[model samples]
Structure formats: C-alpha cells, structure tokens
Target: MAGVTAMTVQLNRMDRVSPWGFRLQGGRDFRMALSVKKVEPRSPADGQLHSGDAILAIDGYDASQMTHAQAQQMIRNSGNTLQLTVNKGLFQSLKPTGPIKFSPAAAYGYSHGHSTF
Candidate 1:
C-alpha cells in the first residue's frame, strides 16, 4: 500500500428513492449485483443483458435513448459492429500481504503471483 491509487463512490438518499415515489419507478431503473449495486443495462435488453459487465461504452456512444434501442424492430435491425468496453467479470477482493506467511508444503518455489495496475 505504498502509493496505490484508491477509488470511492459517494451516494445520496434521493438516489435510492423513486423520482415520483411510485412503486413502478424503482424496477424501471436498474439491476442489482454484488459487484455493481444498481447496474444500467441497455434497453431492448430485458432478458438478454445483465449486471457485472464493465460496460465501457456502446458502439463508442453513450447509452442514450437514441443509442439504447427500444422497439424489437430496432434491435432486429441493429448493425453487426458492436463496439463495447466490457469489464467482463466480477471484482474480486484482495488478500493481505503480511510477512512470512508461506506454506512450504504447497509453495513449489513460485507460490506468489504478480499483477499490474
């Protein structure tokens, strides 16, 4: 932890509450996940898409009403080129790096691993 960068999220109560206080408004917004709390999936994506994807961008475009398809006809007529920036998987927790915690029996000389930021 010498000089690692950290990321954080700030939230407001209004974010959790419905805009109109209607029961239908909540489910219309997002999908819940362990890694990503309220993930946004593109419309015309009811049962196909899901949470936990990195979602860089869609076709180099933001998920706007025009870009995010609505009608089935729009989805069916989609272009073959799908440019996306996906995280691809869930975020995993890291283990602590304490001193001298190797189990020699299972060490096999290359026990530890490396990762780049």
Candidate 2:
C-alpha cells in the first residue's frame, strides 16, 4: 500500500473485479477454456448441441478455464459477436456470430450459420 495513488482496473461485464488478480508483465498462458454456452435452438448450437453442452471459446481464446461468472461478463462485454476458442467433447473450433440474423424482407431476425473465425 506504500506509494500507491490510483489503479487502473478492468472489470467484467458484471461490474466485478477479478477476485484473483495476478500481475505478470508480458504473461501469457495457453489453456483451453469455455466461454459461451448458447443453448438456444436459434443459435449455432441449436439441435447440434444439447442442453448441457458447454460452448467454448469465442474467436481464438480458450474460455473453459474462465469461471461461469467470468464467462457471463465476457459474453455481455463482447457486444453479440464473440470470437471464441472452443473445445467440446471431441469437437473443437471457433465461432464468430450473433444469436439472430436480420432479414430485410422479413424485417425480422432469424438464425444464421456460424461463421469461421
């Protein structure tokens, strides 16, 4: 606490600071993590995934290690299109997209195919 003035903090979408904070300059860890879990049939998961399927990653970041609280915050912060690094039961991949697609003609939203990151 000596010689401390102010701290720049990064909060999750939920407005909570990481209870566990580690500061290692230029630190990086490549660990598989689960980030998002979209069980909506309108999502890429749809019938392809079941209720409990854990959607991992966003674009190329492993989200599995992230706790559920972390995951929720990231999802909300990502603005809809999330590029994740995912790993599931044996199928691993990246998906960048939104929950629903907007149709000009229909003036409504519909499910769109998951795009490759």
Candidates in order have lDDT scores of 0.27, 0.33
Give lDDT tens digits, candidate 2, residues 1-117. 344232112222223221211110100122333322234434333334332223455344455465444554554456424443322333233444676465552464412212111
| Candidate 1: regions farther than 4 A off | 1-28, 31-51, 64-77, 91-117
For model 1 the TM-score comes to 0.25
Candidate 2 versus the native: TM-score? Answer: 0.33
lDDT of 2 at 73: 54
Predicted model with the maximum lDDT: 2
Candidate 1 global lDDT: 0.27
lDDT of 1 by residue, 43-107 (tens): 22222223433333344433322221121123223343223333433433234578766665246
- Clashes per candidate (backbone, < 3 Å): 2, 13
